[model samples]
Target: MSFATPLPGPDGDPLVVDCDSCVVRSPGACGDCVVSVLLGPPQDVVALDDAERSALGALADSGLVPPLRLMTLDDPPTHRDAS
Candidate 1:
């Protein structure tokens, strides 16, 4: 299966995923799945912006929405190696 295409955010920023370089590209749970956004550090908690919260609420209220799954990675892979 193919991965999900990243779309522009409300502010026109590109949401990107480099599936080709991802360590999880094969045999991982996210291999063929769509990811919404890349989050910040684990200790950081963020309140959703008004637009995001509204959109999420709308989607949740919609009957067409599917069950959601949340995944957290302790050490997420990066396309670039540290210098």
Candidate 2:
């Protein structure tokens, strides 16, 4: 049940990614997420540091890759349901 690895943010905070706990862990969401785009399918966890996050954001903004659509339970349910 390892949710996320300790990925340090810009300010030394941790950026945790718990895919299994995500409310929007669906095929559609997974297919369009930056993690999936860069690292293939969704795993139990996907860790990314600040630089990696920034790179993904830049890539997504430039339309080179999809944005990070990992909507966990702590976040609002903006994406569609898994069902």
Candidate 3:
């Protein structure tokens, strides 16, 4: 599956947040906020390619990483989820 490029996060470089309790963080969603945490400063959103997706998958599963897509996630549909 295609994802996005790995960028620094709004918080720190190599940003890695905890999403272990995320209800939607399972394969489709991801457990931790890795993507966002690692996401670099704000920039035009770019679609991820196959290679990028592989890299993201590996990066998101490390020690403590979560999909930080929320870091830069624009006003998309919202949902209430509990882990």
Clashes (backbone N, CA, C under 3 Å), per candidate, total 0, 0, 17
lDDT of 1 at 7: 20
Question: lDDT by residue for model 2 over 6-53, one digit each (tens)?
Answer: 222344444666777766678887787767777788656766666766
lDDT (Cα atoms) of all candidates against the true structure: 0.32, 0.59, 0.40
Which residue pairs collide, candidate 2?
none
| Candidate achieving the largest lDDT | 2
**How big is the positional error of residue 3 in model 1, measured in Å on the Cα after superposition?**
14
* The best candidate in terms of TM-score: 2
Candidate 3 structure quality by residue, lDDT tens digits, 1-83: 11233343332323333343333544545423444456543244444444555567666556344434443232223323222
Worst 10 residues of 1 by lDDT: 1-10
Q: Which residue runs does candidate 2 get wrong by more than 4 Å? A: 1-10, 76-83
Write the number of the candidate with greater lDDT, choosing between 1 and 3.
3
Local error of candidate 1 at 9, Å?
A: 10
Candidate 1 per-residue lDDT, tens place, 1-83, comes to 11111122344432233434334333333322323233422223333444654454355446333211222232233312221
Regions of model 3 farther than 4 Å from truth: 1-32, 68-83
